[model samples]
Target: LLGRVDDVMLVSGHNISTTEVESALVSHPAVAEAAVVGAADQTTGQAIVAFVILRGTATESEDLVADLRNHVGATLGPIAKPKRIMAVAELPKTR
Candidate 1:
């Protein structure tokens, strides 16, 4: 049997799940894939950082990032919203 603990991040005393943040990101029409991680933050303890693979119609720009951040905020909540969003060509894969 194989098992492990759920990867949960603490932000301002709140439990934020990376999977939840990633799901919120992909829900945006412009996003193809997303990976969410926790970054050390002086105020929040940890902040949500997202790396996104955008759709063909999407471009990496300030407006797009703001839109994505707003999308996540609407989908989830302000707390679940990504503090930083980066568009990436691809995410590393392992077989």
Candidate 2:
């Protein structure tokens, strides 16, 4: 697997890798990079939340968010789609 064991998330009894979701997000032309996490959810056990950095030519918008979600769903699967996707200026990194 591309990701470590710890990166696996249990969502609705399905095992999902954060890297897989990240890959799906980055597949879109507008997305430069992506980070995904599993958040506690009463219904699905865990919901996927994504933080994405857009390409310089792209802008953040509600329409873009919807499009990204749909793109993920189509690229991966509906179950793999993120519950929420937030646009961020940059991702935290260690020196």
Candidate 3:
């Protein structure tokens, strides 16, 4: 039986912490902040996706975005890496 502490899955397998992705993003100078989500994926059981808002005059460039994704791979290994990242203007805070 599962207890209150039952684990959750995000992308690569089961029982992943959101902090891994968070730590990856916060390491970048271009990123102001980021929010991650575990969306359903038909192929992998789950998919890790990220929404980012840029910092001080940073343009929304693809290379920087790619670097951020690669940074995740470096920080948390390929398993904890995000499959997709979207740069957003603002976050949906209360929903």
TM-score of each: 0.90, 0.91, 0.79
As for lDDT, the candidate ahead, 1 or 3, is 1
Model 2 TM-score is 0.91
Model 1: per-residue Cα lDDT over 44-85, one tens digit each: 999889999999878999999999999888887888888899
Instruction: Give the winner by lDDT.
Output: 2
* lDDT (C-alpha) at residue 54 in model 3: 84
Candidate that would win on TM-score = 2
Q: What is the C-alpha lDDT profile of model 3 across 1-95, one tens digit per residue?
A: 54333134555455666655766797888888888877888988888888989888887777887898888888878787778888889877766
Candidate 2 local lDDT, residue 17: 86
Cα error of candidate 1 at position 78, Å: 0.6
Q: Assess the local accuracy of residue 33 in candidate 2 as a C-alpha lDDT between 0 and 100.
A: 93
Deviating ranges (above 4 Å) for candidate 3:
1-8
Name the runs in model 2 displaced over 4 angstroms.
1-3
How many angstroms is residue 89 displaced in model 2 relative to the true structure, after the best TM-score fit? 0.7
